[model samples]
Structure formats: C-alpha cells, structure tokens
Target: MADGSNGKPGQGLLGDTENHARVRTTALVIIAFAVVLFMLVQARFLLISLAVAIILFALTSDVIRFIARQRIGRFGVPNWLASIAALVLISTALLVLSSILLAQLNTVLVTTVSYAERAPSAVASLFGWMGEDVETAVFNSLRSVEISGYVRTVAGQAGNLMQGTVLVILFVGFLFAERIWFDTKMTNFFEDEGQAARATKIITSIIHRVNYYLLVKTVVSVITGAMIYVVAQVFGIELALALGILTFILNYIPNIGSIVATGMVALVGYVETGDAQTTGILFLITGAIQFINGNVIDPWMMGRALRLSSFGIIMSLAFWGAVWGIPGMFLSVPIMVMLLVVCSHVPELRKVAVLLSREGLPEDEQELDRLAEEIENRKG
Candidate 1:
C-alpha cells in the first residue's frame, strides 16, 4: 500500500550495490591478469619452447598427414612411422643449422669485440673534417657503451638459445606423439559433436594461416639474406657469411629487425673499411634489400591472410619481447594470429578479435556488408 516514491530509494540502493560489485569484479580481473602476465614472464623459457613446438607442429602436420596417406606397394605408410620420420628429419636439420649458427655467432662475437677499440677512432676519422669538439664528442658518445657488456649479453643469449633448442626439440617430439590423440581429446572434451567440429575447424584454419605465413617469411628471408650476402661479397666486406646468416635470422623479427640489420651492416662496414664511402654504400644496399623484401615481397606473398592491425602487432611485439626477449619477438605474430582466431570464435571475445583485426569488422558485419552489396547490385 506504500506510494511509488517510497520504493525509489530502495531501487537506488540496489543499483549502487550492483555498481560497487561490478567495479570490484573488474579490479579483481585486472589483478589476476597482471599476476598471470608476471608468471608468463618468469616461465618464458618453457612457454617459448611450447610455442615453438606448436608452430613447428602446425607447419609440418599437414605434410605428415599427406605422407601417411601415400601408398607403397598398395600399403599406406603408418601414421606413427611418418611422424617419426618427419621428426627425425626436422631434428637433424635443426641440429645442423644450430651448429652452423653457433659457429658463426662465435666468430662474429670475437670480431665485434675486437672492433670495439677501433670503432670510436673509425667514427672520429669519418668526421675528421668536422671541428675537433664535434669529433671528440662523437667519439666519446660512441665509446661510452661497453663492448664487454655486449659480449656478455650475446654470450648469455647464446647459452639460452642452446637450452631453448633442447627444450623445443623435446616439446616437438612430445607434441608429435600426442598428435594422434588430439582429435579424440577434442571430441571427448566437447559433448556436442557440432561444437567439437567447430573447434577443430578453427584449429585447422589457424594452422593454415600460420603455416602460410611462415612459408612466405622463410622464402623472403632467404632471398634477402642471399642478396645481402652477394652485396657483402661484391663489396669485399669482412665477415660476409656471418652477416648473411645474421640477416637471415633477424629477418624473422618484424619492423625492428630490418632496421637493426641495416645499421649493423653499416657499422661493421665502417669499422672494417675505416671509410665513410664503404659504410654509406653498404647501408644503401642493405636498406634497399630490406625495403624490397619487407615492404614488397613479404606483403605480396602474405596478401590478406593475416588481418592483423598494425598497432596490435606492435603491442604484441613489445609485450612478448619484454616477456621473453628475442624469441618472444619471433613468435609474436603467430601468437597474435592464434588470439585473433580464437577470440573471433568466442561470442564474448568477438570484440577483442575485432580490435585486433585490421579491418575492424566481425564476421556478422562482413556478412551484412556482403548482403548490402548484393542488394545494391540487384537494384542496379
């Protein structure tokens, strides 16, 4: 029998309580996210190994499947045998590549350390025509960075690389062993066959996109590395082989990699030649090669397969780079691809996928646009 005005206060009190609870929940979520991020950073080695293994699996799983389906004398190869053969081949190639890289890195490190003393003088000489004050300032600035620190950092990275390779190999082996069970596990985990099928489709899509990206990257990187090697040899640059291998490896990391490689080539050129002309020519050549490969060939091959926002890519690069260093940078794009694909499938997380996507259009919006286009065409 109370008037409606008396009920307004009760409603307001309930709304306030709900608002407070919502804020508390958001705060807890933020705190939990921060804790998880910290944990990931601390456990980066294991996480990175697992990530690399997954990528390798994605890259080769299809080939393994195709191999398993092949018949020899009317008998198909066993899936397990094919997987084991693939694993052994990949492992052996990895070992050979790793040994070569380690040897090259060792030589480069030694050469770089030796160049430290000469670098400042080389720079000062390049600016010898300038005022004494300018030359002195430049020399001091260049020499301020300790070469030993660089050496130690490189050595630490090398050690970590060795450890990570072992871990990655082990992870890859186990993942291959479990590959057969993956589908059964998915089916068992999802009570609904439709849901399980959808999940499997999403995973397959992810694998296809990631594998295509890696394949394109590999081709572009090799081309760029070979061109740089040719230039280095033609210009008589010291440590040409090392520089080539370094270029190949660095090309895997986006944006920053090309810039760093170009700059490093120039610096090494200047130090070795003790001339500005050689350095300038080397820089120009490296820049051109990087430009053609990164800006031209890479995009042409990748096409629209990776609908990743540029800003999102940068954010992922920085976040993972901070969390896991160089290896994280290498894996950032693949990780982002997984996130974008998974989030796109989740109703609650579709917004995140949209935010991460280059086009900023969800599937529903895309369908609507398509329908609109069709209607317009019919009207015309």
Candidate 2:
C-alpha cells in the first residue's frame, strides 16, 4: 500500500524475496565449491589425521604454556620445544601400546586357531545340548564365516598402522611449528592492526574451547581405559592391555563407543576362555567403566563447555563416518563442537545452534515478565 513503484511496500517485499533467494543460492554454490575442492584434494585420510593431530597439539599446548608461565625454562620453554616434547610423549605411548597389542594379538590368534581346530568337537557338543537344529545352525554359521580371512586383514592393517602413526606425528610436529607463528601470520591477513587483534582474540577463544574439550575428553578416556584394563586383569581376561587401549581410543567417539568396546572385549573373552560366564563378566565390567566415564566423569569435566545436543552428535557421527570412516567418527564431536561455537556467536545462526545444543539460551525478560504477570493475575 505504501508505494506502487517508487516506494511500494509490496515492491520492498519482492526485493526482499529476490535478495533472500540470491543469498540462499550463493550459499549453496559456495558449499558445493567447498565439497568439490575437498574431493579434488583427495586426501581424506590425511586431512582427518592432521585435524586430529592439531586438536591433540592444541590440547597439550595449554600444559606447555602453564609450565612456561612458571618460568620452568630460561627462554620460557619455546613453543617448538613444548610441541616436540608433547609429540615425543605421544609417540612413545603409541609405540608401547602397539607393542603390547601386537604381542597379545599374536598369542590370541595362535590360541584361537588351535582351539578352533582341536575343540571343534567340544563346541559342537555344547551346541548339541541346546538342540540338534541349533547345533547344525551354529556350525554352519561358523563354517560360512571365514575367520582366517578376517585375521589376515587385521594383521595386514596392524602392520601398516605404524606408518600411519609416523605420518600423524610428523603432521603434528608441523602444526606445532605453525602454532608458534600463527599469531604473526594472522596479523598479515588484516590491513588494520586493530582488526587483526580482534581476529586473534576470536581465534584464541576458539582454540581455548577446542583445547579444553580435548583435554577433558582425553582424561576421561584414559580413566575409562585404565579401569577396563584393571577389571580385565582381575577377571583373568587375555589381551587385557590391547582391549584397554582399544577401549581408550574408541571411547573418544560418543554414544556408541562403549557398546563397540564392550562387544569387542566380550568376543575376546569368549575366544580366550570359551566360557559364556567369563565373556558376560567381561561385558559387565567394560559396561560399568563406560557408564562411569560417560555418565559421571565426562559430564563433570565438560560442564557446559560443549553443550552439544545428543541428536546432533549422533548425526555428526554418521555423516562424518560416511565421509571419512573411523577417523571421521573420531573427529566428528570436535568438529561439531567447533561449528557450534562459531554458530553461537552469530544472531541468526544462534537459533540453529540452540537446536543443536543440549539446552536452549536463557529466556527473554519480556517473556518471563509476561508469565509472572499472568500467574499473579491468575492467583487474584
């Protein structure tokens, strides 16, 4: 009604519609271009490993900074030295874990193969007690499953795991070097020093959140792993160390990690002892550790730092895992955490962020006041 052409209200609406369409199209194109570029790079695994390494570096850097703050070194423990130390520590721990796992794996394989061959009759007899049909079905299923093929695949991958580990360490080392110069590099991106400083502050906030989340998650995972290991040892479960390490690593993936770890430990228990009771005990112990870690320790440590919705985590896990596999699953939560942080800063995206978060933002004062007034009137 305001205008028919020069200053029309309907014309403004038309223009707004066109502008919204244009913006949506532009955003879509930009996202498509990014996906195309990522595919062209063809470095999914490398990128995932690098991302994980950088997160780890960021988490450890805080500890290094803390030490430097105490004047532990003359030159305040250069970032490079701190990074190198962190890398060395991580690498050494990985090596020790790999050694333990490989040894246990070899033993398990040998024992399992022997058991399968020599105790086939025993297994059949146990199944026979259930029913003739059940025994037939069990043996048929076992025969159909190629255990040797699976063993070979696992062994081959384990052999190559060392190479992957080395690549990750090297990548993390470079990330550390880059961290030292990151502030200086970021300054060059902005024409105004003030703008650069503001950008640095934003980046620092992001880094702090990422670092804090990783540190807390890592500590919780380690505790869970140690608990699993001790419980397994108490139960006389073979491959306890390997299962413990596996639990620790998998625990990084939320929700489904404990389920996988428990099932894996139970399978190993079954194979090692050929007893359902032992396997059940193993599952119970692992499940209990996971319960404590997931429900108790993690919530205490996270304490609103993440605030990710349960549904958001599950969806991110599925999406990233589809795109990047196991590495994707491991990095999904951290990436989602990063996205939520950025989203929370923007007004429009804040709504979406609220949906993605465990809790919505605080209620507006007007709404609260209206509710209060309504309650008082109702009482009157």
Candidate 3:
C-alpha cells in the first residue's frame, strides 16, 4: 500500500516474484551439481586416473618446455624429440620407483601383519591390571582379521594402481602430442584473440602453481620421511626404512596423512620394544616432525602459491577421499587449485572462486561495484 516510483500497488509483489525466480534457479544449479557429482563418483576409476594424468602433465609440462629449449650446439633440441626424451626418462624412472615401492610395501605389509600377532600381548602388558582373559579376547578379536585376505586385497589394489599408472602414461603422451597445436586450436575456437590469450594465461597460471605445489610438497615429504627414519633408527625401531617410505607416500594426503603415519610408527615402536616409554617417545618425536613440516615448513614454502582456503581444502580432501579413496586425497589440492583458478576468470563463477580462496578477496566484484557507483555518482 506504499506508493513507489512505478506508482503501482503490486510493485513489491513483482520484486518478490523476481527474488523467488532467482532462488529457484540457484536451487536447480545446486541439484544439477549434485547429480553430476554422483555420476563422477560412480565412474571414479576412469575420472580419477584422468585427473591424475592431467595433474602429472601440469607438473612436468614446463620441465619439458625447458628441455626443449636447451641446445647442445647451434641448434636447440626439437620439441618432439625433447618430448620423447622427457617421456622416456620419466617413464623409466616411474617404472623403477614403482618396483622399489612395491617391494617396500610388500615388506611393510608382511612385517605389520607379523606384528599384529604380538600387538595384543604388547597392549596387555601396557595394562598390567588386565588378566590373561582380556589378552585372549584382544588376540581373538585381532586374529579374526585374515591377514592373507588383506594382503590379497592390497595386491589387487596395487595392480589397479599399476593400471592407473599406465593410463596416466598414455594420457601424458597424448597431451604432449597435442601441446603444439593447442594454441592454434584456441585461436580458431575464439574469435577474439585477446580472450584466447587470456584463456592461455589462465591455463599457464594453473600449470605453474600446480607444478610449484607438487615440487615443494615432494621435497618436504622426503625431508619429513628422512627425519622420521633417523628418529626411528635412534629409537631402534626395526621397520625404520619401510616406515620412512610409508611416511613419504602418506605425506601426500595432507592432515590425515601425518596422523596415520605417526600412528603407524608409534604402533611399530610399541610392538618392537614392548615398552610404553618407547612408544610415547616415538609418538612425540613423530608428532613434532609432522608439526614442524606440515605446519611450519610446508606453509612457509607454499606461501600464497595455492591461495586456497584451509576449510575448502579439507572439504576437497573429504569429498575426493570419499569418491576415489587415497588417490583422490593425494590429488585434492591440485584439483582445487584448478577449480579456483578457472572459476576466478569466469564472471559468473567469480564469487565461488572468492569463497574458495584463502584471502576471501573479491577483486573482480569490488572493481565492478566501484565502477558502477562511480558512474551513478557522475550521473547524479
């Protein structure tokens, strides 16, 4: 019943109608996203492997470019040849590393299974008041777990991982082959060359950030693993090397990785020594190492490179970890980085990007608002 500029009684109703329309559109988008996510989970094997291949390409593409630029004499190495050499070298290294890791993992599994048998006794000894019955119960509960079945499951998983690795290798090869014509394709696809260039810039930024993150993480994880090995040796832990390698691999999984690694090391320490003090000391040492590396060193090195919110990362980790398990957890950060970068460039998705970013900056939105206000003020 208030008169407005339109001088109509139903003006407010019209505004409410528009608001409801927007809300419905937003709800539809969310529903669509959920449906797509379910499909992705259903096809996780293919999608996860593809995601891994793309991340691997992002990590290595620049190095391949650098290799292509190098010259032995007057002529630089051809791009094709450089790509081939890089692929061959990387493939061989991966093969060797995979073999070594499989061996180490096998040894670790055997050792851990053997230790499982003694775990009840070790735990019972910790609680001196617990009688033989309690010990027997604990042993029975744990002994019911068929280690051979678990080993077979792990072997099957390892085989699947190898298959994923082969797929990734093939994907990388095709990506390399396409690198040359990518610019041409972009140019043809975009009528505006400037827009095409912007697209390329976004892609390049994604690659550089992902590459830096991976490189830094690998170095930090190796250092953490090495430090863990040293501490294990100092404490006379028997599975020192295996534990170290396991730590190195697990470190890729972010917050959960360090905790799991610490638990494993502590358990092994207790089982080996049967001493509560030794287990406590091992736990403390590993916790300190993880704290230093994960909280201190890793952040310092990454220092704004990712620009991803901590909460967003945890969400990504949980989502991907649930969808694709360990491999998804390992790739969560990189995938989030890609999403943040791409979304930031798209006008419609800029708000989502801001939500994903650590700083919560809305440079695009703020600039647009400022310009609108300036134009309105001049009109006034």
Candidate 4:
C-alpha cells in the first residue's frame, strides 16, 4: 500500500510535466500559423495606414497635452479638442505640401521622358567619338528600352497616392480615439493590480521611446531635406524645392534612402539640360549632403534609440519589402523599434535587444559626448 502511494505521486508529477510541454508546443504552432496566414493575406496597405496613424498620434499627443494645460480664456481646452486641433493643423500643412510636390513631380516626369528620348542618340555620338565597344553596348541597351512604359507606370502609382492619403486620415482619427482609452482598457485586461501597473509602465515606456524616435527622425529628415534643396539651388538644378521635399520624405527610410535621393537629383540634373558636367556636380553635392547627415547628424540625434544593427536593418528592409512592397519597407524600421523595446523588457528576449543596440543599453550622454568629440577630432 505504501509503495502504491509513492508510485501514484510520481506518475502524477510526470503527467503534469508532459502536459506543460504539450501546451507550449501547441501555442508555438498556433503563433507560427497565424504569422504565415497574415503574410499570405498581404494586407500591407491597411497595416501601413494603421502604423502611420499610431505614429502620428504618438508624436502629436504631447502637443495636445501642452495645449490643454494652457487654460486659455479661463477655460481649459479638453484633451480631445486639443488633439483635433493639432491634427487639423498638421493635416492641412501636409495636404498643401503634397499638392505642390505632385505638380512638381509631373513636370519632372515630362522632363525625364524628353531626356530618355534623346539618350540613345547622345550615347551613340559619344561612343562613335571614343570608338569603344562598351559605348556601343550601352547605346544599344538604352535604345532597346521603351520609355513610355516607365511613364505609364509612374502615372499609375500617382493615382494610388490619393487613396493612401484618405486611409491615413481615417487611421489617424481612430488612433487618437484609442489613445484616450488605451490605459484604462489595458489595465482591465489583467486580474492582478500589480500586473496591471507593470503593463501600464511597459506600454508607457514603449510610447515614449517611439515618440522620441519619431520626433528626432523628423527633425533630422527636415534638416537633410533643407540642405539638399539649398545645395540644388546653389548648383542651379531645376525644381530645387520640389526635389528637397522628395528627399525629405524618402530619407525616412534607413540605409538606402540617401542613395535613392542622390539618384533622383542626378536624374533631375540630366533631364533639366542634358549636360553631363552639370549632372555630375548635382550628384556630388547631393552625395555630400547625404554623407554629412547620415554619418554625423543622424547618429548623434538617434543615440541608440532603436539600436538596430546595420545588417538587421538591411534584412528587415528586404523581408518587409518582399511581404508588403514599398509600404512594408517604410514600416520595417518602426516595427523593429517596437520589437526591440518589447524585447528589452522580457528576460528571454533581452539578449536579442542587446544585440540590436549600439552599445547594448540605453544611451549614456557622457559616453556619447566622448565618442562624438573623438570623431570630430579625427575629421579635423
């Protein structure tokens, strides 16, 4: 009888362990399937709109809170009212800027088409003078392509811009509403009060980090854009302001953005007057601005915010681009930032977050300052 009791308890313990393992395996399998299903559906446009809305809400919430605190005219503005006002102002500015850029883009496209038409002849003449087989090959390649197809493709993409704009607005409205209820709703999800408080802290930390990242990035992008515009004007490139705005928008993408902007500027230079010398100068100026911003200013401002490795960023870009196209690429870094923030809080995931970070932890101002000074001295 005693032996039977001992055997029964041991069997019970073994059964519990087996059950736990089965549960973990099942949960993992479900999560994997869900991820696969989401990718297969490719609902990227909707996801992008939601992501943009959340980012806009995070960035603007502080301004809204500040306005509410002012107590103007002896009556404080409500949080929602302040949020709406901020949203309206930001939306109006973006709309006006978008319209202007669209007009400029049309002009640039027409100019590009005209240049492409003459490219074959220009290349052939240069090749004839050089008597190089390579030149002949280049001329033949350029001549074989139909430029109209490219023009049509650009035109088709332009049509989609309006739809994307509308979606962004709708998403922004929903995100603002969600911000108001997020804390309360999240707290209610947990049974324990302590758990609720910890969840709130985690969520708040994530929001703060994301907001700071967006603010710094926006400032950096604007500076980069303004510099590009100024350089274009100095170089006498046509549509300098328009090109500057384009540069600002594209610079939101990490790693590959500067290359795209430089190529665009070179194309503008080539199209405006078909002068190779002018094109070369435009490319050089654009590259210089990118070099300064990407190497010096961006790293200083970012200060290990996302902490993503260069290889991680490139991999994320490729993966997201494959899954969601252009919208995916734009969202890739932000998603990575969110993951890093969450991972940093979890014991098992902290190692991954450390690998992603620049120094494997939050920024220490003194250390960063010392590094910056060293870099400056080296340059000098």
Candidate 5:
C-alpha cells in the first residue's frame, strides 16, 4: 500500500507511529503544564515561601560550610552548629527586614490620601505641553478613579508579608535540618554513582550562578536605593525612607523596575509640590541614578554572569507577575536562571535553554553539552 515517494511500507508505518507518539506526548505536556499552573496559583503562598527558602539556603550554604571548616581550640565547628547559627541569623534578618518594610509600607499608605488628592492636577501638568485640552482630559480621567480604595487594597495585601516571613523562616529551618542528608538521599534515589554525581553538579551549578547574581544585584541595588534616598531627602520629600526601600525592592525586578521607581518618585514629588520644574528636576536625578547603576555599574559587575535576554526577562516578568503578582515579579529572574540551568543540562531541553539565554548559548557551552550527553547516555 506504500506509494513510491512515500517509501517502503515499514518506513511509512514507523513514521506514522512516531507522529502519533509525538502528538500524544505534546498533549500530555500541555495537560501537565495546565495542572502545574493551577497548583502554582492555588498554592502560591507556600510555594513562594519554599522558593525563597531555597534561594536563601543556596546563598548561605558556602558561608555555613566555611564556618563549619574552622577550628576552635582544636575542635572543629560542627555542621549542625553552623546550621543553627545561620538559621538564627536568617530568621532575625527576615523578621527585622519584614518589620521595617511593613513600617515603610504603612507610612506610604497613610500618606497616600493627601498625595492622591493632589495627584490629578500635578500629573496632568506634566503633559501641559501637549495642550490644555489634553491636560484637562487627563485630569478628568484621573479624577474618575477611586485612589483610596486601591491604596486600601494594597495595604491589605502588604500585611501578608509578615505571615509569609514566618512561613519562610519555618521552611528555612527544615531545609537546614535536611541539608546534610541531601547528597546521601540523592545518591540513594539515583542508585548510580555517576548519575548522582552529575545531578549534584547540575544543582551546584544552579546554586552558584543564582547566588552570584543575587550578590551582585544586592550591592548594586543598595547603592542605587541609597543615592535615590539622598536625592529625596535633599529635595525635602517627606517619604524619603519609604521611597528608598521601595527602590531597593523594585530594583530586584530588572529592566522595568527602575523605570517604575523613577516615575513613582516624580509623581509623588509633583503631587506634593505641584511644581513642574521641581518634579522635573527630581525625575532627571532619579532617572540618572537608575541609568548609571543599571546600565553602567550593573553590566560592568555582572559581565557574562547573567547572560539573560532582555526580552526574555520582560516576558518572565509579565508571566510571573500575572500569575503571582508582585512576589512573582521579584522572583522571576531567579526562576528563569534556574530554568536555564536545568534545561541546558538536558540534551532534549537544550533548545529551550538557548531561547532563554542572551546569546543563544548557556554557560560553559561545551561542558553543558558533555554533561547533557552523559545524562542522556546514562538514561539510555
């Protein structure tokens, strides 16, 4: 029954079977993605805390190991002791930071009423050059919105940060408890030394890359935030501390974040002062800070360490923001970094890793290929 151009009956039958198998696999993948998405949204609180805990563990693991290797009067600092110290430090930091952030959030929320009342006229004046008609139209449109209700909603959601902090602390404690046995468990689960070793390498690679990125980002963000805070204080803005903290938090979101923070500062200044010139000056100052840090300092420091595509970052930001809100936005880059590492270490998923990377090549390209091949061969 095989046509001449279609080749022999055996080849044609095999091709049909392969196509059928492909279709079934694609359908299964789609279904699995849908289920995962549903769970991510439904269990986001727990999942987010888990994700944060994992990142914290990765960041501090090296420090803990270093401490554990030290000798105190001929007795080594035990791993358990190091773990307990780290847990205490981490818990204290999270709680303290959460408290400070909540205080800033409350201050901003409380002052929001006055700001909102003056916002429309000040905002519309920014577009004064566009013509009076357009300015009036903008003012009327802004006037129609209920700013109070929106602030109230944000204030309500902000309260959940305290609860999330507690959950993250609990998760980190358990992670520390189990960290020692993780390697043994992985080896047992894989039941093959080589495979287990490869798995461990992949996980370590992910942690190292993620930890480096966070470290560089934190330093840069702190500088940018501090400078912005100084500028706010110089301008006599009442919410200097809150603005600084917001800038620090938003800077973690990547490209879109700095822009949003600058615009927010400009708007707040205008609403408070009702002076276009002063607002314009503050806007330029904040924008310069963001540009200098983000484009200059950040790139020089990060170099090829990040290797993430700008468009890919925006896409990740949008998708995760839609799914998990602001927390998702903050976590997007880390999640993408994890995905890129995992995918690059799998031959079947290498193409996806390329798409996620900046220059169509994941880190240590040849090494990644070798590791992926080894994994595939082992499975085969």
Candidate 6:
C-alpha cells in the first residue's frame, strides 16, 4: 500500500472518512438553503426595493461619473455633487412614473368594476355550446364575486407600492453615497490586487449586460404597447388606453408577458363586440405583432448578449413568480443574469452556469480565465 501524500494510487489514512464529510456538508447546505428561502419570503418587499435601486444605480452610475469629470471653467464637478444631482433626477423621474402608473391602474380598476357587471355574460357567451345550464352557472358564479372587496384589497396594495417607491429612492441615495468607497472596499477585501480587479470587471460586465437588456426591452415593450393601443382604438374598445398601459407593463415580464397581453386583447375584443370572427381577427393581429417584436426584433437587438436557455428562463420565471409574485416575474431575467455571471466565475458553480446558459457556455469563461491567468503571471 503506497502513501496518498506521495501521489500513489492508495486511499488516505482517513479512508472513507472523506465521504462522511461530504454527506455532512451536503446536509448543512440544505438546512442553510431552507433558512435563506424562508427569510427571502418574509423580507420580499425590502429585498425587492433594494434590488430595484441597485439596478437603477448601475444604469446611471456611468453617466454620473461622466458628469463628474466635466470641467466647468476649470472647476471639475465633485463626485458628491454629481451623485446628489443624479439622485434628485432619479427621484423626480420615479415619482412621475409612479404617478402615471397609479393613474393608469386606477382607471383599470374603475373599468373593471363597470365591466364586472358585463364580463360574466360576455365570458358566458363563449360557453353557450356547453349547454344553457353551464353558461348560466358560470355567469352566476362570476356575478357573485365581490368587486368592492377586490377594490379594497388593491387599494391597500397601492399604499404598499408608494412605500416601496420611497424605499427604492432611499436605497438608491445610499448606493450613490457609497459609490466612491466601492473601489477601496474591493481592494481591501481581496489580498491580491489582480483578484480585486477581476471581481470589478465581473461586476461591470453584469451591470452592462443587464443595462443593455433593459434598454432593448423597454424599446420593444413601448413599440408593442403602441401597436396594441392603435389596434384597440381601431376596434373601438372602450379601455384602449388602459389596455395599452397594461400591455406596456406586462411586456416587462419575459416569456409569458406577450402571450398574456395578446390573449387579453382578444378577450376584451370578444367581450365588447361579441363577434367570434372579429375576436379571432384581433387575436391574430396582436399575436403577429407580439411575435414580430418579441421573437424577431428583440433577439436581433440583444444578439448574443442574453444567451440564456429557454428552459432555464421558464424555470427561473416559475420560481421567482412563485416566490415574489408579479414583481418577481419582471425581475427574473436580470436576477438570472447576475446568477449566471457569478456562477460562471466560480469553478465549483460553473456547471450551474452551463445549465443556465443557452449553449452550455456562460459567456467567455475561458477567455476570462486566460486573462486572469495572464494578469497573475505578469504580477508574479
């Protein structure tokens, strides 16, 4: 029997003890994961606001830095001054956008109440072939729903939304204030300067990818919303504006959003006009629009930037949607991007990144590894 330390083909002195250690480690990991999951569910609102603020900060940080570099009559804008100005601008924009969304959502609720009286019959009409009894039962069941209770619930949620917006503003403000210390902090945390630099590059890459994804998505969503609005108006739908706004908001969610928006348009069309042929035509048109924008334009604009697997996307969507609800759905892809990048950089978690990525490769992992090695060799 040769010694393991000498690189001989023999078991170590501990023998199968290593297997026991692995089992314990796996059990501990599972317990830690369970605890983390519970905390996430409990503190969802705070975490969600923080995540939003982080994203907003990343998107605008470069602009703020550029502004800080300007020399106005030999007086360079200080970093703090640039940060404050950016915070103010962001706060104003957020408030305005929130107000607009609230107004739009309020309109939807009001119309929903009015349409509540009509929706049952409209929906029931589709089931007429199932027998008059079935149609009558559906209409009765729908009519029994308490619109007032729903309104009250939504109104309460609206208050929470306002609070969340304020929290996000505060979170962004703190992030901007802390931006100057980030480099120093990173340097101090890592013993090796090269490692610190690599970490910074990785963070920057994630931010850039997320920012680009958001920009392209916003453009595509706006285009889709406009087309939907025009179609609604042409069809003389009463809730044209509301439908457009909903479409815009929903399109922020990936995979399932476009389908929902298109189906919504078709449903509304059928409900309002009670014409099967008209509804079918409207569905076809909206579906075509969504397919063109979502499938064609969006991919072309994104290119290889978002090389996420379709199955992985759906899984992420399902998990986040279950845990965080609608907001989670909106933030799923960005979260997945962060996960993908982080996992790709970590050797042990590289397999997870492969699973998350489109082609079993998370970005240029080999190139980054090579670059890191070169930097280390140069330093040595």
How accurate locally, in lDDT, is each candidate? 0.85, 0.73, 0.83, 0.74, 0.89, 0.88
User: Alpha carbon lDDT of residue 95, candidate 4?
Assistant: 70
For candidate 1, the lDDT comes to 0.85
Query: What lDDT is reached at residue 358 by model 1?
Result: 92
lDDT-better candidate, 4 vs 6: 6
Q: In model 1, state the lDDT of residue 54.
A: 85
**Among these predicted structures, which one has the highest lDDT?**
5
Query: How many pairs of residues collide in each model?
Result: 0, 1, 0, 1, 0, 0
Q: Write the per-residue lDDT of candidate 6 for residues 257-343, one digit (tens) a residue.
A: 999999988987887888878998999999999999999999999998878999998999999898888889999999999999889
**Tens digit per residue, CA lDDT, model 5, 1-380:** 54543656577667788999999999999999999999999999899989999999898887788788789897999999999999999999999999999999899988888778778887887889999999999999999999999998998888899999999999999999999999899999999988898888788767767887999999999999999899999999999889999999899988989999999898888877788899989999999999999999999999887789888999999999998998999999999999998888788998988999999988665675565566446534
**Model 4 stretches astray by more than 4 angstroms:** 1-41, 120-131, 362-380
Error of 2 at 34 (Å): 8.2
lDDT string, candidate 2, 122-162, tens digits: 45545777898888877776666676777787777667666
- In candidate 5, the residue pairs with backbone N, CA or C atoms under 3 Å apart (3 or more residues apart, or in different chains) clash, namely none
Question: Predictions ranked by lDDT, top down?
Answer: 5, 6, 1, 3, 4, 2
- The digit string of per-residue lDDT tens for model 3 on 39-128 reads 888988888878877887776776787788789989899999988987887677767878878888888778867776777678666655
Better of 4 and 6 by TM-score: 6
Model 3 stretches astray by more than 4 angstroms: 1-31, 127-149, 362-380
Candidate 5 is scored at a TM of: 0.91
Q: Whole-model lDDT, candidate 4?
A: 0.74
